[model samples]
Target: MSQLLRRGVLVACLALSSLLLPLLPVSTVAAQSGPAVTTDKDVYDFGEPITVSWSDAPGNPKDWVGLYPTFAGPPGGSSGATLWDYLDQGDGQTVTPEGTLTWSQQRPGQRDTWPLAPGEYTIYLLVDDGYEVVASTTIRVTGDTDGPEPPPEDEWPANPSDPALSRKLRAMTFNIWVGGTQVKFGSIVRAVRKARAQVVGVQEPGDNLERLANRLGWKHTFTSDDGYTNLISAYPLSAPKRSDEYAWLRFPGGGRVAVSSVHLTPYPYGPYDLRDGASTDYVLFNEGTHLEEMKSRLEALSALAEAEVPVVLMGDFNVPSHLDWTSATAAARQADGEDFVRPFPWPLSMSLAEAGFRDSFRTAHPDPVQQPGYTWTPGYPPPIGDQPANLTDDEVFDRIDLIYVHGPVRTMSSRVVGESYRNAHIRVRPWGSDHRAVVSNLRVRPLYRR
Candidate 1:
């Protein structure tokens, strides 16, 4: 009996030692490999709240976390983009492992109205260890509301009649001087509607684009990097495809119209000190050529205009047109006196014409003699930044701003729209810019798309 009792005690002691193996210090293991994050739900209704949490985050309890809206791909380069919407107060707040945050239906700021529009957007969970984005993940949400409503017609002025537009479209180019601060924004908006242009482009829209888009009730609006130009339309606008010299908007629907807006190097000579005189290689290099950037861009615009889809190239060219500077036209404008330089085909205009685009204004006018169609001034005495030495009252007043288009497009009617101070047409209010606006009505040859 004694021997059997000792054997039983030894067996029990061995079992107890085996149970202590896992509790040893070196034997312990972490619950996770690296930082991991997740959301409670993949989708949610508009204004619906969501919970975001992180796990396996090997860090101090007080680590920073942030939430932002991103497009797609890893958190770098083109594949990834971060919108202005940031959920946190600043970069983020410190929190513990398995920390959580809530995304309410409402985002901060005036642009963030609750019940977001029904569009797919990505939510990014960014863990920043003070200096950089450590780990991240994304959640997508489709808005659940009928989009925004347009202001009543009575609220805004009515659009002008266009009985002539059966196959073509009208495009307007307006340089809203100083970002339209010179005149009432309503006046500009009303002027646009009166022209009844389907597509409108403006120079110097600056930061006021959203405000302009809001008032005009345009479905689409695009602003250039420097706010030098913008394109607004009633129809949907495809994402802008751009280069430093130009930006193009693709109009999607039955047929696409690639609209390119450019504010070429003004004077083309300010930086080079040659803007005041003629150049050696007139074609390859000209002081008035705007450092040849204008010619280069116009060439690019021409190539784009030649694409399968029709293209509308418009803007304040700042350089003279080849048609106007011709010996014949020069004789006509001789009233302005023999100008500084004899007629030489400006490279900017020559390149565009060669690329297959005709001046919409000239096309509609046919006779430059009857209607010089000067776009430089409308008699508004507002000071201009580009007042140069060679440009006298006559040369300063010549037509420079232009609308160029290629393909099966015909100008039904084209006219200058602006204040009547010095214009042939009756004065229209809201024309405060030193330059007048060009309104061109064109018939686009129907190109049906599936």
Candidate 2:
């Protein structure tokens, strides 16, 4: 071969070697991995602030961590939308890696707490590394700001000595289910008259105030923009005024006792359609507005009760006082300090407990059954049962109706008239209303004397 041809071939070979060297993976480039972003804490009280942290992703860091909140769920499942925007994107309130991110309890002032109900929420961290996302450990947020303190026990009149006072002051909470066509006016009249309750706080009475009061032979006092209505007996009651989430009824029992009747909207657990099955998300959202309004009203009522007189708050809270497992996914998502607004029940119940009022039903029966009781009865539509089957053994559904007492009233004994529709051993009349009446025997005593 000629020398020139040989040189040309050598040059071509050298060029090919350089190209192959560039194609080969470089040894200095290490595969990136590390401990996931770590939160300083897992659970936090609603309204309180919290901070989260993480070891920087081992890569060419492109952007700070962005947050997308899910309403709590199993990993890789159908989750809700992102609550807040990217956390560190200079959005005025961005949290630095060293600086802590704070979140308030599910109450007034907090951004995400607007539609405060009670439930869980999950916080997901997405680290922007230019090439791919590096997610951190999931943070769980709970709306239970009040902690584990149980409601105050029903206090019977400090001075049972005052028998006359005890007998004269009677309190009760009734959910009239105004939406139901079967809720006859006569039945409500019969229920109130039979109970002989002096100050009654009723819920869902629709717009039939005059007719209901006339039929029952009682004077009407309170009403709300929503269908919630209330009436007080025994003393000349003042006109009803709207408060936090109720129609406040003030009765002059020498000192005064304020009775609030409320109808909180249901919580939303899922999309509008899946409400029949596992859709607590939808229920929380639906009911959040009512809960928020009720919270505001209750706060006002609390202030009034503190200033003027003792309070014997009673009404249909329309929320079960227990942890719900089906909505746990949604509940965890609420924990992340995101700008998402959703509804939950536990948070509201926690707020009420913190406000110094006692749940009369819980106090009356310490170890009440955890399942649904007293409120829901079949016949609403699909899923809840269309026709009434055996009244006995039928699942007692939805413990939404409640009676709560505050101030100086001593709760002696409280029970649901038809707590168990089906007692295998005994027989009783069917519950008058879809919601069984919650009756309590209270002992009222003058403050300071006892």
Candidate 3:
């Protein structure tokens, strides 16, 4: 029994050692975790379903998984709370898993459509194994595409014989908030049509030019390929051009009245580069490149300003009305014959003023006491339990929205609409654009007649 038993035991021990040696590493001995779930699509278009799949593990499988949608502020605080949370539960359509571990889950099906408004949504999948959530990358649901076509050109009333009546044109510059469903095309269309603005300058259009123009029955011209900022008017556009800083539309009204729509380069006070930077204040007062671009554009625009045709420029300038201490000190230092630190004061507004332009709002209503208007602010009440003091203090109390006249134009009245301090009961949500529309009545004396 000695040699035979010994050889049998040695064989058994060697076999056991082979198995146990591989399992000695703590990393290898641990049981395999849940399956790795991945989604084929990062973004889901409206009326389209997303299919998700997983890498199967070599073990007993779990049956169920859960999905949740969450939201967050944009990179630069552009957005507030997650809008998806407010969506009705009925809006979320889901599919239950048919089989266990090794199976794929197709949401809605290939033909099924997810009817969600345009936004950035994330879908989270939690496997029944109690493992951490397997998340699909953020999916952006962009607005539905109707075909693209050139905006319609419409006719305008003939110039009046009376000089006083003919020169008078009512203009409105509005910053339509395109971030959400709050102030949509329907509301804006109704407002613009009712206002009957001869020429409307709009900001933050958000690629909805076609929808907006069609809804309002007005013609539009956009600055970018993506159509972020646009000009919608009853008059025909001559030639439209854009730079890094601004977009200009040449409106041929007798003589050429060039309308410049600007979205200035944001101030570079924040930490990150513009490409990936996030900030509480994304409103740039001066972009170095944008400043040069605007300067060049303004020089070009000055040529269009003839004695006969007046150029009226208006939009969100993203700069303060007057020079601050930083600018004042820099100017003084330069005058003293010393190399001074370059001042980045709200240069755009000041540049326009230097280029023989006048601010119409200041001209019309000289006193700030009479019309204390602040345009940019979070339109809703502060979140529950938050202080009203905090709310009031957080408002962008500066006057960045301005209407400027370059050549021969007189401002009869320029005031911010819908600002009533005495009546705290007024709701700004109905007229809920981020900017208060700066409306002005300009008197343009015809160059030929004058």
Quality of model 2 by C-alpha lDDT: 0.48
Cα-based lDDT for every prediction:
0.57, 0.48, 0.47
Superposed on all Cα atoms, the candidates' RMSDs to the truth, in angstroms, are 21.2, 13.7, 15.1
Q: TM-score, each model?
A: 0.54, 0.49, 0.49
lDDT score, residue 233, model 3?
64
Per-residue C-alpha lDDT of model 2 across residues 258-336, encoded as one tens digit per residue: 5566655432322211322334443444344545657666776677546533456666664555422123323443354
Give candidate 2 regions above 4 Å deviation.
Answer: 1-168, 179-183, 224-229, 240-253, 267-291, 323-345, 370-373, 378-396, 419-432, 445-450
- Candidate 3 versus the native: TM-score? 0.49
**Tens digit of per-residue lDDT, candidate 3, span 1-450:** 799999999999999999898778655477866545455676665545545454442222342233222243222132221111101112223333322221122333221122433455554344433434443346665553332231221221111111232466666677666632354445456555555566667777776655667676657554544443457666555444444223443335553355666655333321121223222122132133345646765776666553434666767765545432134444554465433222323345556666667777767655443443445443542122332322332233445666777666677776564323231112232454545567777777544421
Better of 1 and 2 by lDDT: 1
**TM-score, model 1 to reference:** 0.54
lDDT of 1 by residue, 318-437 (tens): 766656655566566566554443454455565566567778887766566677778776545443334322223423456777887776566677788766545644246645566778
Question: Among all windows of ten consecutive residues in candidate 1, which has the lowest summed lDDT?
Answer: 267-276
lDDT measured at residue 217 in model 1 versus the true structure, 0 to 100 = 82
Q: Give the candidates in order of lDDT, highest first.
A: 1, 2, 3
lDDT, residue 290, model 2: 47
